[model samples]
Target: MKKRLKLNLQSRLQIKTVPSIRLANFIELPEKEFSRFIEAVENNPLFLKLANPLTPEERVIIPQKFPGTRFSPHCFLSLDEARLADASPINLSPVLERHHKAIKLIRKLGLDKFQKYFIERTSAVLPEDIARILRLKKSQVEAINELMNEVSIHSEFYARSSLGTGHKISYIKVAKIEFDKDKNPGITFFSPRHFIGRYKIDYEKVEQLKKRDFFLSEDIGKLNALFGKLELINRRKNILYQTILGIIEKQKIFFVSGNKDDMVCCLQKEIAHKLSVHPSLVCRAIYGKSLELPRGEEKPIKDFFLPKKEYIKRVILTLFKEHKKVLSDNQTAVELKKTFGISASRRAVSNYRRELNFPSSRKK
Candidate 1:
């Protein structure tokens, strides 16, 4: 009962896609296309016969399936005569072909290819694991890393609910810190703006295309796929933002002084819970993603994972410096739990102390 219809025509054409800003589903074709397609069917006898319009008061004749029976051609016009009275130019061959090709190419390839294409275009890799997955030659990866070194986007200072309304709100001033040509560090903040691609498309322009007389029928379905893909990319970018903001909000002291020592332990699960997403999603978002910090540097999101051994070392060092006597590793473990909330086994504490040449007990 359904088959492809072949039509040959020549006309200037362009494609427009309408997608919801908040949702990643559905694409709708403009009304003008429907009107034009109706006109095209009227002008072509073959298509008109296939459409099979029925007349009022005309008795329906069911066609016989017996061989050698011939039936009169039939045509249908769902739209009223008044609606089709307005003549519209309908040409869809070119537009349908283009949309079909693009959709076909997208479906034929996997996400990895597209990810690599974007990475190549944006040069936006930061995590070592992502680099390994990219499988780029060592030279190519290093070359891209060193090629373009400049601040691309800028952001403004702002404040939010401090991650919890109960907690005091905090102001954020992101600055690009770079040393002057003479080697003196200078701080600069860029104009505040939403990150690019968040809401770049103008729906009004797409609406304007509705006034046209015709569009490709395939465009609706094809563009839906295209827009869905675009929305996914936007989602990834959003995840990166959420990840960074959550980290900065939780570990305020580290970013304040720009010192690793100030970094408190931040777990991936903690961030995932705060963002209300899966821990695996948080991991995927941070994989190969880096945020351009106010310090005019790019840092991997994974760097927020406080190194356990290093943290233990710092905690032990603090305990040793503040105490008058060397405490047993067991005592050190207990003190670590009490003071820094770090749970460390006695053997682990002893090994770290011995590795650092700190005696098991303080010099009496």
Candidate 2:
């Protein structure tokens, strides 16, 4: 007969928002052994074959199932997000509303031209590339000397984002738990759990990080290349302002002429789904953020889209963009429905103005 010794103990080790053993992406370090890192990430069964792998699939997420209960306590999070989410919660209605309005204003202002101009500063486009893309005069392209002083694109404002909805992630995490070994050989485990982090990230720096490279990356070139792809992150706090304003600008079509019924239904979830991101991402992007409009008005970005229609948006922006001193939504809606086939009602229009998040509107 064979006897076994058993030690039953439950010890909980809490990891805060960070501790990434994962290798850096763009900027490489002398201390970090790249070959070993590749081997670990590639999971080459032979270990030495990381240098020469037969399969194209290098980093694979293997899924597993634990049929039952979890034993240990783990507060796992995407370290970066937790840091951002820690420093800023998306729940700040005031900030979100303001951001929404400011972005709306900025879009009305056409900041993309600014972004485009900024990029034109860093990278040059041969006449061939521009000919394939846009139709313009040779002198006009040459005049872009004003646009591209550096003879290249600077990548200051292209960012990837969509509206988002909150949801749970589906990655497998195993936490072995107490089980009866007399009947079962393998211990029970827990996975896919969500927990809050102990520390917070600096959004101020995260914002600063837009123009700058992340502190830890495998290749600076790759990081810079990633920067060129992502214009959202910028060197200034104002860029966050610009981004929200940009989101507002992009969604201007739905806001101005469309109502709750004809409205494009810009649900955060729908936008998130379109962009293939988690809702918390949308939440984070929109949180603790506000804007100062021209009228000395301040509000959160969330207030802009939570309502059903964009009719008020069209009226207000048209008035401001086209430079009309005062135009009523009733008048605007009538013109839109009659001329452009836009759907809006007068009462609904007033409600829309009220939704613009103007504090004085509360008096109405």
Candidate 3:
């Protein structure tokens, strides 16, 4: 017989919300369960290679089958059952009772569904209609309508967010240069130097725990201490912020308007010095992160720190003009290597020629 062992968690279990193909796209699964599944998948290399990987949603959700059933013990619902449980009719009145209860309801419905429910239900009922239906005073109905409007706005905001709704950004756009006495400092341009946002912390719930009878004074003290520690962890900014800011500050002219001519050679040590940080720290900060640009394009942050490769394409174009005819890929590669000491393969030369809209040498 196989032994079934249940792992007891002493600390809080972090839940994962992943995107799904199902109608309920925001699938919340236990961290342990998801980790175990991932491990199982990793064991089968062939299956992993063939399988379509799961993508994570921008929003995080705590899904439950019904109200007051959070950490919902078990989830064994059929697809048909899930499709049938419409969120529009679930008792949303409980949500208005308390802030935490509202959060719970939002979690239960998932952000997408809850927003849909709110929009559909509220749009169908005016304040007067709600007063008549729910037998509430006009003032109460007005309040409810106000809250629903806020919910709708937040929903639309999250839906349109780029770089995931999880990442909140505060940016500072400053002029690239100050006017010099002799130099032609005529044009003023703006560029984003720093990006930041406050960490989300649920302090209201911590304060609410005082009302529970089971929570003794000592427990409250311990909880406060735990919150303090948690706050410290959450409050610390991402180390990469300073590095990115340094890069932007140093390479302001190039980044400000995406003009390649304005670009100057920049090194990681230069950025580190600008930010008063170590060179390794600068490297680590920009390793995997991408910077969102003003033109709705995103480029790897590290790309900006490296030497620009556009010059190679320019040189190839110049060579073609001088030759007064398209050059063969091999011919171009040999010329680049021999004349400029540039190591370019025939394939790379071919690609550059194609990018420049020149016919292949054979076609010419």
Candidate 1, residues 14-100, lDDT tens digits: the string is: 011212233122111121232232234223432222122232112111111111111110101111223223331233233324344
TM-score of each: 0.40, 0.24, 0.29
Which residue pairs in candidate 3 collide? Answer: none
Candidate 3 lDDT by residue in tens digits, 1-364 = 0221111121002110111122021112221232233334323432221121121111111111111111111110111223223432233333334333333434454544433233333122334554555455666655543444332222111112133334444211211222234432221211111111112333453354345342455555555444332222221112344444455555667655776545555678875554444466556445434554544455566766754346577778778888988889999999988987888888888888888899998898
Q: Model 1: how far is 347 from its true place, Å?
A: 3.8
Q: Which stretches of candidate 1 lie over 4 Å from their true place?
A: 1-194, 200-216, 273-299, 355-357, 362-364
- lDDT of candidate 2 over 213-291, digit per residue (tens): 4333444334333333121111111112223433444444433343423333345554344333334444444443333
| lDDT per model vs. reference | 0.41, 0.31, 0.40
User: Which 10 consecutive positions of candidate 3 have the poorest summed lDDT?
Assistant: 67-76
